[model samples]
Target: MTLTLEERVRLFGSPIPEGFTVRVVESGTVINDEIVSDTKVVANGYDLYMTDKVFETMRDKCLSKTSKVWGEAKS
Candidate 1:
C-alpha cells in the first residue's frame, strides 16, 4: 500500500507549485555498521516524480521558445 504525499495535500484543494514534484518515501542509512533506518516517510533518492501537467507545460514552453536556447525545437 504505497501512498504519495502530494495527494494528501491536494485533498485539501491546495494547488502544487509549478516545476516541482513532491512525494514521501521510506528511507534508511547505515551508520557504524548498524542500519539506521528512517521508518518515517520522506523524499529523497529519486522518489520524486514529475506531474503530467508540468511535463506538458515544459514541453510546450520549450517548443514555443525561439531564442535559440531550444535549438530550433519542433512544435
Candidate 2:
C-alpha cells in the first residue's frame, strides 16, 4: 500500500516541519542517479523547494540534526 507524505512523516519523524503541506518528487540527475535517492521537497506549489543536492545532503544529515530535537521516535 502507498502512503501519503503526511503518513510517512507521521510514521517516521520528519526532518522537515509538518505544519505545511509538502510534496516529494524524484529528481532525475544524470550522474550516478541510480545509486542516489534524489528527492525534492516542494512546499505549497513550489513556493519553497529543495534541490536534489540539498535534499540528499539534508537527508544524510537528518539523523544527526534532529536526533536530539525529536528524540528518536522509533521503536
Q: After superposition, how far is residue 41 of candidate 1 from its true place, in Å?
A: 16
Tens digits of per-residue lDDT for model 1, 1-75: 442333423343223334445442223433334332333322345343334444455446444443233255464
> Model 1: residues >4 Å from true position, as ranges?
1-43, 70-74
Name the TM-score of candidate 1. 0.27
Per-candidate TM-score against the hidden true structure? 0.27, 0.33
lDDT of 2 by residue, 47-71 (tens): 3354557666666665554554466
Residue pairs of candidate 2 with colliding backbone atoms: none
For model 2, what is the error of residue 6's alpha carbon versus the real structure, in angstroms, after optimal superposition?
A: 21
**lDDT for each candidate structure:** 0.39, 0.49
Report backbone clashes per prediction. Answer: 0, 0
- Distance from true position, residue 11, model 1, in Å? 38
Regions more than 4 Å wrong, model 2:
1-12, 22-47, 64-75
Point to the candidate with the largest lDDT: 2
Model 2's alpha-carbon lDDT is 0.49
